[model samples]
Each structure stands twice: as structure tokens, then as C-alpha cells.
Target: MNRTTPSTHPSSDKGHSVVAAPVTAHPLAELIAHEIRERGGWMGFERFMELALYAPGLGYYSGGRRVLGQRPQDGSDFVTAPELTPLFGEVLARQVLQALDATGTDEVWEFGAGTGALAEQLLGELGDRIQRYVIVDLSGSLRDRQHQRLLKAHPSLVHKVIWADSLPEAMSGVIVGNEVLDAMPVHLLSWDGARWQERGVALAPQGDTPHPTFAWADRPAPEGVRPPTEHPDSAYPPGTVTETHGQAEAFVATLAQRMVRGAAFFLDYGFPEAEYHLPQRHGGTLMCHHAHTADADPLAMVGDKDITAHVNFTGIALAGQEAGWEVLGYCSQGRFLTNCGLGEALARTGQASNAADIQSRVALQMLVAEHEMGELFKVIGFVKGPWFEAIGFAHGDRTHTL
Candidate 1:
């Protein structure tokens, strides 16, 4: 959502910061604090993040907040490609069509279908070709919003859409997950040249305020635990902070395992392993977003903001490969979208000076510009059945990079 990379700074008490001392207790803060106490005043950053983003009825996504939109004026936290323009899905649908035909499947599964904007675009473009459109999302509130949007937009085709609470034992479809992996909980790790530690969350002592303030707390990581990097500990400068995407990797492995026949395409902003863990990237990619603005402090606003980390494409590819899936390709979003005809679609808008056409053109540029989402956002495709040359990766395929 919010695409800002903020550096982590050292604090007085070890490397942790006393993030905030709230004037009043946030309900979610209290809940997390109680859990910290229950767990002996410490909680792994992964669990803390899971609670902060997905705890039932209190976390960010499950808290009934309007998260995705074009701007802050709509009371939305951040914007996604689908929200930026319908052309994203329209172009992606071309790739999905190829995957569906190659795998001989008529179903489509979308994880974390934010606002259902992409779903609407795909469903409209693909039409009767798709027998079913299954959405697997954790946010009940967002699911309700998606239902209403889809119903109003495609009244006759609404019945083809289904909401699934969880993945079944077996499924066949072209799966899509846009901006999903980055949101999964990641384990925070900090290296101090000599040793590495697992950074977690601890409640700061309660002062005059009734609520608890959160702070960073580092404990010796398990003997073998470390960042998935080829570099040695000596290569990392002291106080270098980073993240390991166990959950995200496992999620991909699970998807690879469950799909009987189909392909999956995930689009997100991230780097390959080598770039992700470069010595200069010591600050790590963990970030928080609220009202379309971004910050590095996730412990401050609690459930009021969205927390995320950059996806490790190398790790994702390995996970899927190890779990019986073949990598179709990986490349920049710009290249993939262009291969799928995004540039051609933009050209169709012509020289019309209408506001809608102008806006569409601008959005298309943002999607493919190197300084914008084009270079930063990447698409990775996986297939469980026979591999075919996907149109999205017809050119500039970077599968070897991963």
C-alpha cells in the first residue's frame, strides 16, 4: 500500500524505542498488552504483528476500517494498483486467461482481494470464461464491501462469486494475490556484528497513563536463526535490522501444495534476495501506513495503521519450487504489464482531452514508470501443471535473478 522505505534508528535502551505513551488506552493496545503480560512481558514480533493486523474485530484489517482507495480523502489508508486504475486487472486478465487455458481450469482464486476492484475488472473482462470467482480474505468488513460492490456492478454475474473463509484441500484455478505477501507477519532480526537476536515487542512500564506503551525488545535468537542472506555476519554493520518471511514463504508453499492444477500470479513491491539483504539495506523494509502516509514505527498507532515488509522474491520462489510448483517467470510490473498489452490499452485512450482519459493515462504511467510502481513492483508466476510460456513474461523475464 504505502511504498516508503524508512531506516531504523538506534534508541537509548538497547536498540528499542519507547514508541508512544498514549493519553488514552486503545482497545487493541490493551488487548496486545494483556497478551504480552500473559506471555511474561514479551512477545515475538511475528505474533505481535499478526495480532496487530488480523486479531478478530480489533486489528487493522479486521477492525472495519476503509483501507484501500485512491486517496486519503476517501478515508482510505493507501492505494493499490487496482485502485489506481482498472487497466491493471484488465491487463492482468490476459495473463490469467492464458493460465486458465493452459491448466484447463475455469476457476479463479484471489487472496486478499482488497476492495474487489481487481475482481470487478477481471470478472467484467473475462465474463463467461470464468465459471467461478472465489475470494479468500480475512477481513469480514472488506468482504462485505466487496460483496456489495460486485453485486451492484455485476448483478447478473454476482452468483458466480463466492467468499471462502479458508482454503479447501484441493483447488483448481488461476490464483492471484496482489499486495498480499508483504502484509504477512515477518520475524524481525537485528544483527550487532558479533551476534544476531530476534527482535520482539515489550510493554513499556505503565506511567500516569492507564495504557501500556510498546518498545523493542531483543533476545538471543535461536542458535541457527538468522537472516536468509549469503553474506556473513561480519558483512552486516552493527545494529543492522532485517526481517525473515517465514509466514510468507510458508503461505506460498501451502498454495503450491494445495493447487491440483493451475497457476498463481503475485504482484508486490520487493527485491530479490541479493538486493534485499545487501549491506547497505541495513534498515530493513518493515513499515507502517495510515491516511496514505507512512512511518517506521508500528508500535505507536497499533491497529490504526497497516504494517508491512518487503517481499523476498527469492524466498518465495524457493518455497514454491520446493513444494512442487514450477516458476513460470518473474519480472518488473512494467515489463509484465506491457507484455500483457498495458501500453497498447493506454494508447487506445487516444488524444481525447476528457478528464477521464487524462486520469487514465496518468494512472497508466504510474503503473509502468521506472520511478513509480513499474520498476519497484514485480510479478512472479507459478504453475502446478504443464508450464507454458506466459505472455506476461514473454519478454524481460527475470526468473534467473531469483
Candidate 2:
């Protein structure tokens, strides 16, 4: 396991910046290009996302680069909860403890333990009381690093740690995946004002070299689309483009099928079914991350960049119900935190710290406020059995909040 940051290999010089690092042919980039060519040069954005996120060894996550690398070029690409504050984990611990006690299990399984920050924080909060802690992720190097970090942070809890390649078979415990589902492959569907078509990527021949371009595939309008765009409301434009997620359904279905007699909590950015289908969001929510900047060009950097789509919470809830799990609760990140006593937590910390700790309070507010990641990100939980009495689900109208 290496802590060194993986290099982003630029695939083409066109549309690249002088500030952009020189092009290096990462194996994943070549494979993606070849795959596109083999597929007659036109593949859906979903296919592109599948390749970017899960394509064997060459994809963003599969290719050994930091998929959570959200920071910037000098460092990694991204910073999540564990990266921002330890309090995030403490609050999560409080929530997880509620779920664990309800489920009557002491197991904790985490997916994509980015930098092991969440794991370290949760373990620190749970202490020796937690019976088992497991991480299901691909980066073996990251798993080793996580092991070392956890051991150093809580040597007493080291014996309880477990690492696996996938979710345990019919395990009874609390499962936590933060900012995970957004990375799942998303099929981009657009209403051309006449018919529904899926956005596909293809190889565009540029002299001796090739570049990727967006093309359309004939498909039915996603289930959420409305035939007549007649909004008797404000802020919505007629003839606007809209996007809905089909991939999120598949992922949630998979989770629902596997999760039996336990609780599953997923935290990501998205809206409810009604809000998700609003006419204002016509441009679609598909975006790519290149050198920390958001770009629409999925083919710009190949495997070196991050491509993500917003999760559809409505779809997740529907899929979870279909998969035989009970939808325990749903809420915006703000309401979920508030229901989880975020305000009280902040007040308690405020009482403990001096003026210097003001920044921490501000940051906490940012996480749960209406304007920040609070509204954009949401928390949804599914329980297989009688795991009730949690803060977020029992009290808040997550639907109205959205």
C-alpha cells in the first residue's frame, strides 16, 4: 500500500491546458478508447461511466488513481467527511449506534473507505464497544493504509478490524457508504423536445487521432419525464432538458437484495422523485472532474478524471422497497443532521471551545445549512427488519424538506 498520489495521465493534447500536465498514456485510457472504437464509436454516457468507475484495472477507481481524489493536482482529487472533520464521524457514530442497537448487531461495514478517515473517526467514537468493523473496497493499498491508521488511532480496537472485497453474505449489522452511490454509472437521457434519447459517447476521428463526442441513442423517455411541459408554476422553463437515473436503481436494488435483517444508510447528493423531475433541471446533472475543475467533456482526460451523476433518492426508495427492504427514512443532509441533533452537537462543542473554535461551528453549519452540501446532499436509510427509533427518520419530513 502506497500513500503516494497516483498521477493523472492526460490522453489528448487537444482542449488540454498548458497548465495541464503532459499527456501520459495510462493503460486505462488506451483501453477506453479501444472499447469505444470497438463499439462503433458511440456508447452511452452510462457505458463511459461504467468504464471510468469500474472497468477492470483501467477505470478511475479500478486504475489505482485516487477516485476520491477531489482536492487538487498538488494533493488528491476530493475531500469528504473524514477529510473535513472528525466530528462528522462522531455524529455518524451516534447515528450508527442507533442503527446497531436496533438491529442488535455490533458489525460495521464501510464501502470505499476513502483515506480511512470515516473509519478512523467512527472507530475512535465507538471505541472498544464495537465488536467488528469491516471495510469493503478495491484499493488493497488503501486497505493496508487504513489498517495502519486505525491501529495507530485506536490500538485497542485493531483486533476487531476486517477487510473484504465485497459485502458479507447475509451479514447482520449497520452498513455505511458515504458519497458512494453518486459514482455509480448513470445513463444520461435527454428530451429533445420531441422524443427521449440517451446520451452516448463516440470516437470522433480528428486526422490521425480520435476524440470522444456526445451522440444520442433512441430510447423511451425515462419514466419520470412528462409529455407536456406545462408548468403553472414559477422558475421552470418549457422545452428544458431533464435527467433521471436508472443506474441508481440497479445499485440500490443490489443493496436491497443483499441486505437482510439489518440497516443500510446511504448519504449522497440528490433530490426526491417529484423535485428530481422538475422542469428547471433541463441541462442534466452529469459532470466530469478534471484537475479538480468540473467539466462536461467525459472524454477529456480518460481514466485520469472523475465522472459522476447525482443519485435519484426517489428511485433509491422505490428500488429499496421493491427489493424487499423497508424504507426507514429519508431527509436532506440538513434535516437529517438536525434530526440527529447536529445543532445540539454544535452547541455542546461551542460550550467546550473558545473563540478559536468558531470556525468549526461555521463549518458544521455549512454541512447542514440550507445553502451548502446540506440541501444538495441527502440521507436515506433502509432497514430489513424492526430497526426503528432513529433521529432522522422518525422525526423529519425529508420529502417536504426537499
Best by TM-score: 1
Expressed as tens digits, the lDDT of each residue in 1-402 for candidate 2 is 011112232121112112221243566656766777788765666777788677876777766665454356544565565566566777778888888888877888888787788999888888765788988887665677788888898888888888887654567788898988877787655444444545555544344333333223334446654422334334444234344567777767877787766788898877776666666566556666655566555556667777766677877888888988887788777788777767777877776556546655766777776666777888988888885867776566564432
Q: Local distance difference test, per candidate?
A: 0.89, 0.67
Q: For model 2, how big is the CA root-mean-square deviation?
A: 6.3
User: How many clashes in each structure?
Assistant: 0, 8
- Give each model a TM-score: 0.97, 0.83
Candidate 1 ranges with C-alpha deviation above 4 Å: 1-24
Query: Model 2, residue 274: displacement in angstroms?
Result: 1.1
Write down the lDDT that model 1 would get. 0.89
Candidate 1 TM-score over all chains jointly: 0.97
